[model samples]
Target: MSGTKPPSALSSVKITFLGTASAQPSSTRNHSSLALHLGGDVWLFDCGEATQHRLQKSSVKMGKIQKIFITHTHGDHIFGLLPLLASRLNGSGGTAEGVEDPRLHVSTGENTQPLEIYGPLGTRAYVRNGLMYTHTLLGAPYVVHELRFPTDPLGDFTTLPRNAAELPTGRNIDQIDGHWPDVFADNLVTVSAAPILHSVPCVGYVVNERPVPGKMDPKEYIPAIKRTKTPMSVMSRLQQGEDVELADGTILRGPPRRHGRKIVILGDTYDPSPIAPIAMDADILIHEATNAHLPGIDPTTKEEDTYETVEMKARSHGHSTPQMAGAFAKRIGTKRLFLNHFSARYAGDDDVNAETAEVMNAIGSLAAGEYGGEVTCSRDLMSIDIQLPK
Candidate 1:
């Protein structure tokens, strides 16, 4: 599972990792950034430094990003926000030579739909200050949504779900269902957020697609079609689960549809336990593995910190290790786990390779042997296609 090639972008939910490094940048890995291809729209998560440059290297168009979700106000996570916004507003993401470059704009003319940015309390302040300090003139439409817990940090949290139907019911809240922040949702998909323990206020996101309609049994319909001589035009309606009356007054019913895909994307966090329930049965879990050691392992026992033992630094920094990510995915019962947000020390050196090998093997073994799932170490520009349940 660690090195398996991802499927094509045609899948219903395609996740592309743009930046897999943590606060520090390595030659090969940039900061933290991820792109979620939902239908034709693109949603970004944690746009780190040089994320626009990272986007230029990927197939995703920056202009197509409708919403940007920031996990927290950490510099590594939100540093690229201002520049990315400026590019979109000034049309700098457009092609200068009219060539088919990945950096070129996919949309032409003025964008009518305002780009919506969602994040915790400090997000609006950070964006506003960055724009003011940089003296950048914004010409494109945009909006910022600040998320907050309704009562407590673990209580009802605010989000901008595309549809009202996606909101959790009052009964569910009363039952103290895992606090899933209602994020943006649409007719086909629902995105939720949840708080995770970190040095600052941080949140994780989940994208769940609606179940698709089941295919009609042609054999069952064929008999009715022969008996009633039903018109071929009504076949489409019958398959859509509509009770269609045939030419001879025969009624045909459709079957229940299948469930859709579910994906969970997290930010830089130390304790991801709060998201366990919300991530239950998720198709994919994108989590941070900033260290190579297991959870609770202190890499700082020695007076001087070395590359060989950095787990202690991760613990002090409120970040998770590969084992922690694997363990969390297993507890949540997710099918696939992608570990990212790796420290720069593990970028492309022999020491890092050895460390990564050890970490990956440990994650895979633990996920399968203990947690009943699979784990993969994420890399820059890695594309994973999330297929709908068969």
Candidate 2:
């Protein structure tokens, strides 16, 4: 079999919600974990408590998870890391296969690849303690990158560290670019992170696919090369948007490729303003909506929520309300916004569906009505296929 394969359609980015609960897990919603499906590989964000079990129930492939991005050091956001890593180190349980993509099976033994974790400065210590206490061993090698924001009291996270402190050795990861701090990059996509406002140090991530090569008209080239009998291998180069030399010394130029999709996924945050600029015009924005209104406070009542009331209720907790999340989405102008990290109170009495709908309607009514974008609530195991530009 040929090892070389044609480039995939990177335009299609799928997001799978593994766990979407806030600090406490409700009857239905688990702790927060989201999987970004980029072709065959999966990029996970915010593996909260019981996330490994959530992954076990979902279609997300544990073996194919190339990178794990932690928003902060909060237990609700990161308590599940060590166990998940241990599961990966050992293999997918007894013939357990991928639910969505059947081709994705647990590749054990020699098939394992290096798993990388990206998070704030204290992440190294957090993971180290988890491993030490649990006494977990790993078959697949892993690396941790700790991103630190400026410590100056006056300075917010406007300026972020270019490179993270690589774990074990506590050295910095080699910088890929002078201007943009590159966290990870492959032929399919590039991942980058920036600091966002939360009670703790939180990082928001952006994943962008590489440019796709433009289509080549075989009808135009085939007839012209009929007399010369050009090989199919040479034609492959032309299809890849490369300039090809014909037997008659004529150069066949290929068209410029199209740009792929751009997505932004943020962690738990009270303030979304810091991430708004970075998420500007994104194809999709996954932001936390930890506050929907105190239970029994009817989400539709605008009169009840005076500025002081909301600030005193939600802001002090380092969490964003549906209104705050919506306003932020409006300001950022993301094409689509997904409200995640629901506070357990929203799902009062185990009516998660009704509560989620109420929250979505409340947020959608606020942001999408005024901002001209789409707003939807995310639930565990819900998958959204991102529609990209042509």
Q: In lDDT terms, which candidate is top?
A: 1
TM-score of 1: 0.77
- Per-residue lDDT of model 1, residues 147-166, tens digit only: 66554344223332212111
Location of the lowest summed lDDT over 10 successive residues in candidate 1: 164-173
The parts of candidate 2 lying over 4 Å away from their true place are: 1-12, 91-112, 152-180, 215-217, 293-304, 348-359
Candidate models: Cα lDDT each: 0.71, 0.69
Counted clashes in each candidate structure? 9, 0
**Alpha-carbon shift of residue 197 in model 2 (angstroms):** 0.7
* Model 2 lDDT tens row, 1-390: 134443545745799988888989987788989999887788889888888888888888898898888888899989888788878766222233534422123333344455788887667666666655544444446677666555523322223221211223332333232112667777777877776778876778888777776766778877756757777677776666677788988877766667678888888777756555556777788888776543344655466666457656667888877667777777777778888888775552223466556655664565455456778777788888986666
